[model samples]
Target: MAHFRQFAFKQFGYFDFYHNLPNQLAQQDYKSFVKIVFLKAGGHVVVDFQEYQLEQDALFFINAGQYYRFDTSCIGTLLYYNRDFYCVEIHDKEVACDGILFHNVYEIPVIFMEPATSDIMQGILREIKIELAQEDSGLEEMLRILLKQLIIRATRIWKHTHQVDNEDIRQEVEFSRTFSQLVEWHYTRFHTVAEYAELLHITPKALNKRITRYSQTTPNEVIKSRIMLEAKRLLAHTPLSVKEIGYKLGYDDSSYFIRLFTKQAGASPQFFRQQYQQA
Candidate 1:
């Protein structure tokens, strides 16, 4: 395995590049430092356990520690670099993508793109390619800025695609981003919408409204979904028993957790674990 403690980048000019990918790239999980993809062709992808089907030109953003894979061979430009290369978390206030574009579960991973937008993205990557070819002293810094520009463009699209037309745009995006972080912190300890509402210092109605505006789901639904995503990840990757997994998820009664997993995943915990492990 290659440990990218410093930096790395690549441009897959054609589907031929897929031949170089190892089988584990598709079957096992890995934490990507940062990955940005612009696909001229269409295909499907599975990030974690959630599957996404892409049928048009699209741009994708994957942050560190998220498991993902391309489902089929397609023409695209793929850029991946390590955290040591450009620490987004350290400069998060500057880029503002840590929550919204990177670790955002509320937002979709794939952004459908217009042809003109696609052309512009391609142009930026091409410029980055040129910079890579030249051994310029400031090459890394240049790539970082280009990466920032690409992320900012994608952020605009996410806001546009998910925002309600008449709302205060900044407030909506800000609230949702904050709320998502809150959910991550509190989901295990507090699972109710009202509990989260109190934490956000808002009424339950306001919380639900915010949740719906950004994620198209209620507060409780988002909370449960987050819990369910964790459950699936643990089952797929860990050796803990189903009862133990349930307990780890904060359920006192394992059966209740089993019901919740079955409801959200369309299969019992054991079945899901067996199927995924065997796959």
Candidate 2:
């Protein structure tokens, strides 16, 4: 990590890495801290065995223990922090990225940016870079505030992009947001549209309509996607066998789980694991 970027350490375990990152990220031992990378210009990043090509400015919020390899041509800002310094979970209400961005393993690790938002993000990153440069005793609090603002802004963009209808953005945003939360909470035990609909205080029909409208996917798709995302993560990160992984995801019949995963990911669980491990 030290070889990858110029770093600054502030109060109480605060650490930030800002660099004009090269095309290929150097692989050292994996890290135990979370990473918030603000990428601009043009490049690619591979995270959790998935590759993303960034043609525009992007924000990548990655949790601790995830693996990432960046394109050598990548150029932008990178910030790293651990629970000891500042925990996003403790400040969830203030920053609000606990589910949607940071702790979310289902969502992609990239947020493609619009120009206006990109300008603001770039400005904020520049300010952070400048603030960390001097011997300012008050840098911690200022950086915390700035980091919170950045997370809120990034969450806004994330919700807007994932929302089906931006016309009544607020209401629909809440609807979709609550739906996602429900999925995260009960996805393991509850897998039906009607069950989730009941929890959301809406009809199954209304749930599907909102999900399809904003997410461009059916309720069943979201359920399956969440289940499959977890299954994939387990397969990639754990030594669990295919049958064992399936059972953990609540599949009584291992064959059914294998079929579902193959259909969605275009490969068998074992095959996907092999490919990922070899990568």
Candidate 3:
């Protein structure tokens, strides 16, 4: 059975806890807000054409504008909040999950919690549920604090998993985070490593060296992957032709775009789109 409790403050903010993912999301303007989904019962989730097995204690972060859906039969809790409630970019200093948890390019945005950590997170969710049920003058502030706590805790877990254990490692993570953030913001318009390196105020060689220190994928590969992912998303979901999609991704030459996509995705765009749709 699908069950949910939602708290919305007009256009300012919104929050909800869903026992089962509802069909209304298909109609909901999902691109307008950020989401955190925690699975208490094992299930499957699909985000941006990628499927993930959601075992107990697994948390998935879905950035705004991403394609998100799930097995509505599974038991889980979903949290939704818009920028007006608590902007991740503006408050990134407080929680530090803007790029690491949400828009991360090198890592999948899912966190697996140990049992103890899971308990702590569950407790925080309980507090949020209780707070959402109340009516008080400080309701907004309380919910924001709770949301920050959740993001902060998740960021810590992600850092630990990614081996951000020391100052040097932390710096590497920060640099990688910044690079990933830049790529996310400009992947549609910029496709070259040199361009991103210029944006980062570093030489291409230095940028490659630093990024490779944090991730096995080179900076160019990262950019390519992001572009390919968006291409795949459009090809799967939109009726746009291959040339249009290529042009949208900053490639004026359709054949070159096709070659690049085939090389990176291991399938031609037409084949990939046809196969994905048939699946």
Candidate 4:
């Protein structure tokens, strides 16, 4: 069985990159993580399966469990840290940053800061680099302190820059958050949209309407996408056979599972597994 765990900062590691290459190298699928990137100097970058032309001062935050790849040619400083390092319990008690509280855990809210804002962030990054490089007593404690400060500043910047728009959008965001949490808890046993709706104490039609309004897709599509994502992960990372994988994902009929996988993934389960192996 697959289990999800929260990220903690004390167990976190840091990687700083300042390289320029031509071809892309790393394509990762993270299960649960968070990354904060400060583009000290860069031309073009790709994240979350999309390419963005980055300015020297671009700042971005990425949440866990997202699939991402990057173009190696871009030269920049990136801070790759996991959510486990943040220690959610500690953060909830100690930090009161709206951006970190609302955005960082679930979605990657990338905010483009102005020049003055960039200066403040760069200063924090410089301190973090120093802290990471030195061998000192209570290093983890220092890092956690720096991370909290960073989150506080970033959240302030985010709130100042991007104002909330509408009440409907807020409701949609809440619904999406609830829906994602439910999916995380009950995905294996409850495969249908109606199952999720019943758990949330709402009709399937209402659930579908809200999901469609928020995501531009129906509830069934969201369920299928989450299932397909897990299927791909298991197919790529594990040696389980197609039938076993299907059964693990709550499908009893292997043939029906194969058809559904094919419909959504554009390939049969066997073929998908083979392709991942080849890659």
Candidate 5:
């Protein structure tokens, strides 16, 4: 039994409400929409080839343009929406989630919820489903409110978990978010810590210290990881040759790119592509 329901307005956007996770999610790519998944049970989600096992109640936030798939299906509630619908003309401001929840590359995107928090979030999801069940004129606005509520609560939870209470800590968080946004915008062009540090008006050493203080990896590692993730995605999904992929990723020297990718990924590009194809 597939428990999938959807509501869409051709002018606005589309929303999917899932009582149970569907396997089709593995096959379909929603490159233009952001996604939130609240899993009630055990499952696995793969984001950019990194697999996360969900042993308990958890929430996942996936930004648009990233390659993701449900490796194991579980009973869950999912919300998918693009910016055009959520940030329509009538809205004065877009949801604050674009930076913290969806685009913060330093933090792992999954939130493992306690039972109390899970119940609260589940209630919001229930209201969304209820709103979707109706076809009234106010349905779009009501659904928008519900979705914004969900994002706001999730952002609060994320801030609480990361302890962004103090001014110093908040400033650090802001730096990290800006760094992430910069990296997202320029990873294809700027591949060095010094480049990003210059953009942040800080030294590479200072940038690394700030990033490593809050996150697990160094600034250089984060940039490399983002580039390698894109390389892996293109290799697995596209028919581009190794040299073509390397050039696309701003690497003119194919041999150097191959060596760097092998060192970082522990396999040659061709081997990795073949493995994904066989799988």
Candidate 6:
């Protein structure tokens, strides 16, 4: 087995990446780490895979391990920092948010910060950049402070924009979040809606109905999607054989796995892996 090094933020490390992303919509894929885009000026940004849209003055968050594309011709500053950058010890419990706990594609939480809040965030980012560029010995201390400030700001913004107080939406979001977490933990073994329903303390029928109502998709579809996503990730990033990957994901029969992959991804596992490699 091969071990991958975990990503971490280090003291005295300068982390900064800025791109004036060109116009002309293009598809992009990410492997790990989330990105927070504060659209300074842009026509419209589309998260192709999710069918989510963001216009000017809207903030968007993308989780690691999801494939996405952006529209052509938008001018904005992109912040590409690892989640580890914000993991600092603080006295105030409220100063730290559980941003690092979420590591799934559907776990991405996005909120549009108000104009005043956005300006404040941009200013903090600017200060971080300035501090990173400096050669001072205490630069790491300054960067850590700035990163904590940014996380706190984001939490406040999310709290303000959160629409969960609407009971219907709240239930929907909670159910969806719980379902997602369950899938992440058990995708390799439990592949049935009834199994998940039992774990969630809901009837299978009720679970299906709630899933369909909230996501406009059946629980079975959601399960299959999660399975397929794991398959894709393994195929694209690891040197695992199709049979091995299928078996690892709970498909004992490789032929059945190929058929399922074809049904969900419109291609065979080998073909999909080859295509991804070629790209």
The true-versus-predicted C-alpha distance at residue 216 of model 3, in Å, is: 0.8
Instruction: Give candidate 4's error at residue 265 in angstroms.
Output: 1.6
Candidate 4 lDDT, tens digit per residue, 20-40? Answer: 322312433333556666665
lDDT (tens digit, per residue) of candidate 1 on 51-84: 7676767887777666666755555666766655
Order of all candidates by lDDT, from best down to worst? 3, 5, 2, 1, 4, 6
- Report, for all candidates in order, the number of backbone clashes: 0, 7, 0, 8, 0, 5
Instruction: Output the number of the lDDT-best candidate.
Output: 3
Candidate 2 structure quality by residue, lDDT tens digits, 36-80: 887775777887667887888898887765667776667676776
What are the per-residue Cα lDDT tens digits for candidate 6 across 1-279?
A: 011122234322222222324321122323354555666544455442344444435455555555555555444545444546554565243334234224333535555656787788779867866775666867656766776776667665664555445668766766776787788779899999999999999999999888777456777887888898888878987899999999999999999999999999999989988997897
Q: For candidate 1, list the clashing residue pairs, or say none.
A: none
Cα-lDDT of candidate 5: 0.77
| Candidate models: Cα lDDT each | 0.70, 0.71, 0.79, 0.65, 0.77, 0.63
Ranking according to TM-score, highest score first: 3, 5, 1, 2, 4, 6
* Pairwise lDDT winner, candidates 5 and 6: 5
lDDT of 5 by residue, 7-41 (tens): 46422232343433455465555677777878765
| Residue pairs in candidate 3 whose N, alpha carbon or C atoms collide under 3 angstroms | none
**Clashes in candidate 4: how many?**
8
Displacement of the residue 89 alpha carbon in candidate 4, Å: 3.8
Evaluate model 4: give its lDDT.
Answer: 0.65
Which residue ranges in model 5 land beyond 4 Å of their true spot? 1-22, 26-29, 87-97
lDDT for 244 (candidate 2): 92
What does the lDDT come to for candidate 2? 0.71
Query: Any residue pairs clashing in model 4, and if so which?
Result: 7-83, 7-84, 8-84, 8-85, 9-84, 9-85, 9-86, 33-64
User: Which pairs of residues have clashing backbones in candidate 6?
Assistant: 23-73, 24-72, 24-73, 25-71, 25-72
Indicate whether candidate 1 or candidate 2 has the larger lDDT. Answer: 2
- Local error of candidate 3 at residue 229 (angstroms): 0.7
